[model samples]
Target: MLQASDITYTYNGGLKLVFPNISCPTGQHWLLLGQSGSGKTTLLHLLAGLRTPTTGSVSIGGTDISKLRASRLDKFRGKNIGIVFQEPHFMRALNVEENLALTQSLSGQKVDKKKIHTLLDRLNIAHKLKSDTSALSQGEKQRVAIARALINDPVLILADEPTSALDDKNTREVISLLEEQATAAGATLLVVTHDNRLREQFPNQITL
Candidate 1:
């Protein structure tokens, strides 16, 4: 479902961050592991098309996203890719459901209330649908973040350092939730992190 080849990135007046080619098929779960400076985040950003690679191409479902124009790429990402960052971000003024509705609308999708409710229900956060984001506990917040990422039923889900802030129990729960949701949605799940504890749990792994 996703592929990257010959990837390299460079910051202004700095060294290049090179990455190995990555390929993941549909409905598969993958772990991307690397040390702190190993370009894992850079690689994830390139795969998500958040940063255009200095070299090589990223392909999703056979489309070469590297060749797409910025506007088109943004739309394409909105419709096809879902990302979970290390720190979950939400509009403080918006309630949980409103934030989800806003995300769908930003992607040019009309609000799918049924979809939103179903996603939150699956994440066990249906009760928080009308609550302010600041009111959620950490685990609840993470679950909500996962819900937001999956709100669009994206074909590919990319998570960066998702387990970094959690305890072993929460870490396991989050990872399990991500895998389950990806399977349920028929989307590819790729998590990039320095958390070695995840190594034993995932069967498919790539190191940078």
Candidate 2:
């Protein structure tokens, strides 16, 4: 479960963003919709512990991540939170398998090759395991991103602008894939997107 309350972030030059309180329970899927400059990505970063809010706390599974030291926060986020950025930034020198393996190692977990393969298989990206990430098509890369995000069996999955560049068919497929994988992992899912096409897809939604 995830809880964020009294969230306000201020950037330099006096830009301020105040986010609504969020309380998402385990296994639920929620969508966060906002227009450009609405701080959707900023809010996602706060919830994912990638950034600290200026005025609030974010709790995942009862731990106040904002209070964690950097080292501990890094390890905890790696293990408990899976983030799918709009751009999948894989290390250029690493193949899909190596990239995913690095994620496991970074989380202080043993590299589970079986887990890697199974996740790739489920995402239909098994054929790309040894392939360089740059060689993948857009959809393939997105699937691989999903595979990487699920490789650690994170308790919460945060996807930012996941379907912004996709057509209707691929958008639906990606959303379905995320939902299916999250359900299987027993993880709460939060998607931050500006796309109006997804408005009707999630009944539990927050619009900024």
Candidate 3:
């Protein structure tokens, strides 16, 4: 489960963005909607533990991540929080399999080839295991990103504008895939997007 309260952030330029509290229980799915400059991404970062909120508490699975030391927070995030960014970033030189393996290594886990293969197979990208990440099509890369996020069986999955660029059909497909994967992992899924088409897809929604 994920819980956040009194969340607020201040940009270096003196801009302050306050966010609503979020309480998403385990295995639940929620959608967060807002416009382009509505701080959707900022809130996602705070919830993911990528950025510290100016004032507030963020707890995941009963651990107050906001107060954790930098080193411990890094480890905790690696094991429990999975984030799929609007743009997938990968080491250009690494193959698909190697990229996923790197995530495990960073999290202090030994590379699990079998798990990597199994996840890729489920995402329908097993054939691209040896392919360079840059060589995959946009859709394929997004699928790989999803696979990477699920590789460690994170308890919380936070996706930022995952389907913003896709057509209606692809949007539905990607949303379905995210929901299916999160359910399989028993993880709480929170998607932050400006896409209103998704409003109907997730009944529990918060608007900024």
User: How do all models score by TM-score?
Assistant: 0.98, 0.98, 0.98
Candidate 3 ranges with C-alpha deviation above 4 Å: none
Model 3 residue 191 lDDT score: 96
Question: Tens digit of lDDT per residue, candidate 3, span 130-206?
Answer: 99999998888899999989998999999999998888988898899999999999999999999999999999999
Off by over 4 Å in 2: none
**Candidate 1 has what TM-score?**
0.98
Each candidate's root-mean-square deviation in Å? Answer: 0.8, 0.7, 0.8
In terms of lDDT, model 3 sits at 0.93
Better of 1 and 3 by lDDT: 3
lDDT of every model, 2 decimals: 0.93, 0.93, 0.93
Candidate 2, residue 36: lDDT: 91
Please provide, for model 2 over 14-48, each residue's C-alpha lDDT reduced to its tens digit, 9 standing for 90 to 100. 99998999999999999999999999999999999
125-205 per-residue lDDT for model 1 (tens digits): 999999999999999989989998999889999999998999999999999999999999999999999999999989999
